[model samples]
Target: MATTLDAPGRGTRRARAPHPAPAVQAPTKKYRLAAAGFLSPALVLIAAFVVLPMVLTLWISLHRWSMFTPITDMEFVGLDNYRAVVASSTHMAAVRNTVVYVGLSAAVTIPLALLLALLLYFPQLRGRGVVRVLLFATYVVPTVAIVIIWSNVYAPGYGPLDNLLALVGVDSPGWLSNPDAALYSLVIFNVWQMLGYYVVLLVAGLTQIPEEVYEAARIDGAGPVRQTVSITVPLLRGALVFVLLMAVINSIQVFDPVYLLTQGGPVDATNVLSFDIQRTAFQNGLAGEASAMAFSLLVLLAAVAGILGAVRRRA
Candidate 1:
């Protein structure tokens, strides 16, 4: 009877009985906002400089843009520029030259670097520190300075190298002027410039091999050559692959030597992809064609990188 009185008020009291406060939710929105704030600057810069430029280059590659034309005047030629560049004999020759340069550089640089590294890192070698310093010093020298110095050395009429060759009853070929020798001269210059860095890199790799392993091999009557081929080379496979890939990529992009030294040649014999791209864009006033060439080069580089990555994974 007492409970039946004032039903609305009783029900209200029962409903208002204390329940647990809502569980404190993680402030996910605030955290997201904070992360966005932290990342904003880098994301903005990347988009503005890299992403936007790449997009613009792709767009321009589809048009007939040139130095002579206004933005509005650019004809929407769609892949015509790409076709022209790919079909051009000059461009094809440049591509061939680039491949040759990369192949030759890799052929020369890898073994030479490995040999230098072995000579420097061998415990039997004397004056290892001095040799290392001398070799690595070339890496720090300015590119322009190196070019000038090599230019003097390779000078046809009056250079010391040519003079020495003349005294030895050998007529020196025009190293920079002759089309056949010009590319070889660039290769020599590149090898000399890159030799020290590779030596240092390989030496670093060699140092990581444990002394106990070599000692064990020695105890098994393994001589120096056997130890190198079986132990050292196997251990150094990673470093060798890294060096080979870098050399290939760098050789493909060779421009400075060809530009400052040969200007792509006595007859376009040394014109590589990079120099050709520059010449097409600036000298020939073919921006669209240049962009197409650049994109094609990018694709080629990407494919090479992918192959190297896959090989590394398999290893």
Candidate 2:
């Protein structure tokens, strides 16, 4: 600053501090190259496996093709395949089943998982580790193996479950063979297979809540149920959101059990979107239509994720 008189007679001035020179930056070209090298493999894999297929699917959705024929043989059909998806009764049923399955799975899995997590979080609970291991084993085992085990578990007549039901004077519904019960049976299998994973996630969330908070609640006469409703639920919202998203995605993309057990069913009952897409593409030789269905699924997932994000932000 220029020297200034405090008053015309005093002629006092404020002193300015000297500025420091800017620091020299080291060359970042090599650092950036090393970083790129580290990320290259993941980037390449995602591009090749995820991006390429998605682009190919989108392109194919705009054309007509059969897997048996050469790609050169594909004929441009614009949005006819998409129109077919909208018009087809089987496609509509698959969509409905997918929505219902996701809804039912979330309803059954979230609260049950929360309850299991609460039980498991008790520090003095005996055999909790063993119980956790057994529960998670269902998830860690190959999905194919789980489906095989469940198939027998749901077997009619001579099966253990059926026999037990018989002893109790309860009838077996031929779980996979009854159209009305087939989809529900698959839902039950999914809940059993995925329950442990969600419980483990919720348990992790529970641990982050300091014990002092719970102690304070108890001192204030908060019961277990009250603590869970006010403290636990509010604090664990982040984990619950994650679990909800995973459950919805898993439920919507479910295919293995339906494929292995019901093969899209005693009727069209267990015909979910994923199975329907696979059947349409390879089994029925309607690649174009299948691509359209896949694209539709992609759209649905994106929309749902966006909505969830909005809700999360609002909350």
Candidate 3:
């Protein structure tokens, strides 16, 4: 019924209009306000507890102040407090003791911890779980209580240690009273207290390693020694790095044992920076000098952490 002319436009398809892409909707004003509301508490707490204290310490360090005097009476002393600290033999002894304590603690703690972790990591090991709990309990116990227990164990005569040594006809050395032994006694206590923590950390790292890796090593004729040296230690590097840094930090900040056991006594042998800081602030009433010492220790820790970070990155 239609000629080609009559069937108008039937053979030609019309081009459809292109649809536009959807617009990206920006967040509403209420969303940002709600986010701010959620973050405000944490922000305020950090400012009040962390940032404000740091700022106050820095401000105080620049002045000659005393706890006995009004804050308004603080005199601007610039770097004199720092200079005095540098020149003082007491501070120098503190620094030396801190270095030795940190060094020895890290040296003994890490390997001992690794060994303990390896001992407990086996599936067939009986009572491993109980042992882990007991060890960690010792760590979580109050530091003061730990010092008290160790003091009894190290008492000059008829102490548990002395009694044991007496069986072998050996005279007990003064653990806390002797200048040479006080710091080392504290070190031993630190190592014992910290060992379980590092073991836990290493155990966590050990779990991350796939069993397939060990199986492959076994297939390649690897003995337990080879497996540990080649496989376990290499893979546990990350955990070890963290443990080392933390151990050093803890060692440097040691005050509890020194305070409770030795009180930096026997010619100031057990004196470390933290105890010195307390002595300066409370005993000497040198608030400004204490602030300076605290800030200096902060700087040293920052530098040490930075160096460790760089080493970790390189490794």
Candidate 4:
């Protein structure tokens, strides 16, 4: 046998050092304590402002609590306030008006916003930035200031709108006073005020749609109208859902315009749920009833949200 010259211990396998197990250090008590400290303030705020208020409102809704009376004197009226609200014709009328306002406002505002977004989104449009700023300016403006400015425009005969209508040999109705026209006039004002916000939202939605999709559509011989109808609207469902829900809620809670301009006006043309709640609470001195109304409004909003959520999920 030929014995090969080999280094010492070459025939034996070298002993390998075992790999160290990953260090299993537990979080220190101090680390947990620090996290607790960071979370405490936000938890406290939610408990105080949100949770506490909701609990108290529920409690008050169960009783006939008066602002003028002592807490000890409060009587448990159960659902009498809600029953009364349901039974009242005025409340029913207010609900109807609110429904109409919300419906008409959404119908008008959404389409106008969609159109404006489409127009402004075009690459060939000039001064697009300036126009967008001008449109959005109304949304940032104070509600009171907007009301004041529009009050003049809605003024009878001598106002800008009235003058313009007169130039065309048309007479202007009293937008703030006439029962036939007041609610619709307010709807118009609301649409104008909110148009820019929804337009901005839709424009944002438009930007998210990839340019290649439109290019592909064009190659398929789809014109602008076809592209918008077939592609744009369907892709914009998410933004549209948000806009629709917000529009309905805002319209339902309309108070300032009715209060400031009409005060629920001639034959209560503009008496919405929010205005009704305000009048019940402060003006009519029905605190419990107002609380019930507030809760009812909350329920209405919840129902709307649920329906819309279901639609979105189905889509």
Best by TM-score: 3
Q: For candidate 3, which ten residues in a row score worst on lDDT?
A: 1-10
Per residue, candidate 2 scores C-alpha lDDT tens digits across 215-290 of 9999999998899899999988888888888899889999998899999978789899999999999999999999
lDDT of 4 by residue, 1-315 (tens): 334454576864445567879999998999999999999999999999988987777777778877777778778999998898899888888899999999999999999999999999966777998989989998999899999999999999789988999999888888888998999999999999989988998899999999999999999999999999999999888888888888888888888888888899888888888898888888887788888888888888989999987776765
Looking at model 1, residue 271 earns an lDDT score of 89
Of candidate 1, the 10-residue stretch with the lowest lDDT total is: 1-10
lDDT tens readout by residue for model 1, 1-315: 112334664552223446779999877998989999999999999999988988888888999988666778788999999999979999999999898889988899999999989988886877899999998888789888999999999999799989999998998889989888888888899999988988998999999999999999999999999999999999988888888778888888888888999898889989899999999999998999999998888889889988887775665
Instruction: Give TM per candidate.
Output: 0.86, 0.88, 0.89, 0.87
Off by over 4 Å in 4: 1-37, 313-315
Q: How well is each residue in 205-236 modelled by candidate 3, as lDDT tens digits?
A: 99988899999999999999999999999888
Clashing residue pairs for model 4: none
Q: How large is the C-alpha RMSD of every model relative to the true structure?
A: 10.0, 4.7, 5.2, 4.9
Error of 1 at 164 (Å): 2.5
Candidates 2 and 4, the one with greater TM-score:
2
Local distance difference test values of all predictions, in order: 0.89, 0.91, 0.90, 0.88
Higher-ranked by TM-score: 3 or 4: 3
Which residue pairs in model 2 clash with each other? none
